[model samples]
Target: MINGISYYPEGRKYTYFLKSEEYKQILDRLEINYENIRLYFSHSISFESKNILEIYLRKCVLDDTLDLFNFFEPILQECFEPETNQYKFEQIVDLVIIEKASNI
Candidate 1:
């Protein structure tokens, strides 16, 4: 298993989780033979409001090139705006892969 913390701009953070089935599917799609795979991630965004998250995402896209902006614009549009005092959180993404052994 792999575990680590991810730090984002404006001090935003999130925890991530990836299941074995998901990893298996990824490997299958890539035509890779893996003996095992695991992943984990952590971040801090528990105290952020939806607006803050939106702004953060926007900043990420805006500060970068068009490719980055296009990549995140859709996500920003799909994100729900939180209530006046509500908070929004995010999760992390981690991945690990173990290759199958070959016969000697």
Candidate 2:
């Protein structure tokens, strides 16, 4: 019954919300051994507007070259683009990972 809530007061960062039971259910459904399984979660925020997104990429990656933009364009489009321009300001990612048992 693990629960977490993160608030980004300035809205500059991504906020993540997760429940342990839901993750456990997924592991159970997949028949993944959970005896010593470990889980990790992380998230980030991105802009949807191509112009703003390009600016952001440049700041973060230190490169605004066309090759870089093209490399990340498709993935960003699918993950960050919003239905409406008004709602395209930000995107929050919810990342989850399962760590293997030490014994294994």
Model 2 Cα lDDT, one tens digit per residue, 1-104: 11111221222234333456677787777766554334443323444455655665555344334354565554455455354432132333334555564443
Clashing pairs in 1: 13-43, 13-44, 14-43, 14-44, 15-92, 16-92
lDDT of all predictions: 0.43, 0.45
For model 2, the superposed segments whose C-alpha errors exceed 4 Å read 1-49, 85-104
- How close to the true structure is residue 14 of candidate 1, measured as C-alpha lDDT? 38
Best by lDDT: 2
Compared with the true structure, the alpha-carbon lDDT of candidate 1 equals 0.43
The Cα RMSD of model 2 versus the native structure comes to 13.2
Please state the error at residue 49 of candidate 1 in Å: 8.5
Q: At residue 31, what lDDT does model 2 achieve?
A: 62
For model 1 the local lDDT of residue 10 reads: 25
lDDT of 1 by residue, 1-104 (tens): 11111222322233234566787787777777666533343322323454555465555334433343254444433333444333333443444555763531
Clashing pairs in 2: none
